[model samples]
Target: MPRTESPRRGRRPGDSGTREAILDAARARFSTAGFRDATVRAIAGDAGVDPALVMHYFGSKQALFVAAMEFPLDPAEVVPRLVAPGVDGLGERLVRFLLGVIDELGDANPMLALVRSAVGHPEAARMMREFLGEAILDRVASAIDTDRPRLRADLCASQIVGILVARQILELPELAAADRETLIGVYGRTIQGYLTGPLESS
Candidate 1:
């Protein structure tokens, strides 16, 4: 017969390193093995704790994921800033914002963490969609003056997101090698067209 140990036998709640250890283990496991494969048992084993303790601290895998991937930026603020009066020079502004987001957020871009998890989990992708729709698209659409601002906002978002994914995340060669100024120069005009272009016929 297999030996059965008490569920609460491992690390206790007040242990100083328990939280950090679990987070570290989660990041490594989720990054390498993905969310589904990176089970509580595996993370607990990696952190040298009991699986029940992982549940005790984080409740569920979804809750643990949210806790692990929290970000600094408030999307409500960011959307307004992105469309401020002087932001006509959107390419430069976008490049600056993207670089600044990386700098300001440092190791805490929940968007990036969401992307990583989405590579392995559908729920993470859904969360990202919800965030973009509420925090980004809805605000930007309300702020713009055009009749179909929502469509324009969506297109602009898709283009910039695609660029970021290709350049930063996937490391596309030309984009990855280009200087910030060059990238802004190339993509800024394109963004402007999307923002205030002639309305499309139905």
Candidate 2:
């Protein structure tokens, strides 16, 4: 008999496993190339799929990121409460809420991993920035009364991102070993100052 390839031997050239394959390829490409450098066509080529398929599934790079890094709480739902009307203790509330979110996930949380990825991967970083801006900061800015609330929200994010990176990602003992209440107390004050305090004149 003539040599013949098996039916499933080579994924049929144009396979429907394209989405999963694209993601796998994307994960690798994004990790190695970073976000800005990783193109959709490149990812699709790696997965042996058509570029159109990649666009069809992911819609856009931003949407693909949101899907890849879906967090537990919707910022839409959480920020309103955090930035509620007449909220005087914004710092404490933010600290409590953020730490509580981390603690609630125990060991299964994806944040640490995502942070690690973002640290080493530029594509992941872009994805994270988009999610943070659209999901968390924008909502908080809308809910608060602070002058330049968007800037304030960015400041708040800087504090939390630093904490998460140091404690969770780098595992710095000084920060990671601190008790929850102590950490919350300190972080709360910082967040409160950012939220309601005077902004330095630039």
Candidate 3:
């Protein structure tokens, strides 16, 4: 009888298990190393899958980030909505959009996962800071033509971050029970002050 060849073995391409493994690896990389450092090769290595599999499952790094973050909407589109109301009501518009996303998740806030995973990791923290500052909050401040654009942006970020941590992560009853309009009104006002109100003593 002819000798039989050994069977080729490894994860099949594009299997759901492989995709989940990639997601798990991606979460780990992004939470520890941040987006820029979390390359396909590194993630694939961690996932024990082919690098090409990662690309096959997720078209690009950005697409991977969007998937990992479970982001509800496109910032490019939603960010402009934050700007649509102009300077005066920018804060309110932003709050509505953001909290609306949380609402969409029902029981889970995807952002909470990002924050918890990134809080202790310096690279992850930096990525989160950059994202919030550059992608979301900063754009609003820049759009509003605020007196101190960067400062206002940072302040706005802090407010929203605090809310996310408290309401969603910490599960504060007062915040969790509050209706959307109420939260929006309160947070919106607070953010409005950060956006346009005077921070310095008169």
RMSD of 3: 5.2
Winner on lDDT between 2 and 3 is 3
Query: Where does candidate 3 stray beyond 4 Å?
Result: 1-29, 36-64
CA deviation > 4 Å runs, candidate 1: 1-68, 103-108, 199-202
Tell me how candidate 2 scores on lDDT. 0.74
**With candidate 2 superimposed using the best TM-score fit, by how many Å does residue 137's alpha carbon deviate from the native?**
0.5
List the global CA lDDT of all models. 0.68, 0.74, 0.77
Please, what are the lDDT tens digits per residue for candidate 2 over residues 1-202?
Answer: 5498533224443576656666777767766675556688887777776777778887876455445454565555677777775448878988998899898886677777777777786777875676677767887777668589989989999999898888876789878889999998989999888878899875
lDDT, model 1, position 127: 54
RMSD (CA, Å), candidate 2 to true, equals 5.6
Model 2 residue 157 distance off true place after TM-score fit, in angstroms = 0.7
User: What TM-score would every model get versus the actual structure?
Assistant: 0.59, 0.65, 0.70
- TM-score between candidate 3 and the true structure: 0.70
Q: Model 3: which ten-residue window has the lowest total lDDT?
A: 1-10
If ranked by lDDT, best first, what sequence of candidates would result? 3, 2, 1
Q: Write the per-residue lDDT of candidate 3 for residues 1-202, one digit (tens) a residue.
A: 3375322225677455777777878878876776666788998888777888789888777667677777765565678776876888888987988888888885676688768866866777877875665466666766767478888888888888888889888889988999999989999999888888998978
Ranking by TM-score: 3, 2, 1
Kindly indicate the candidate among 1 and 2 with the higher TM-score.
2
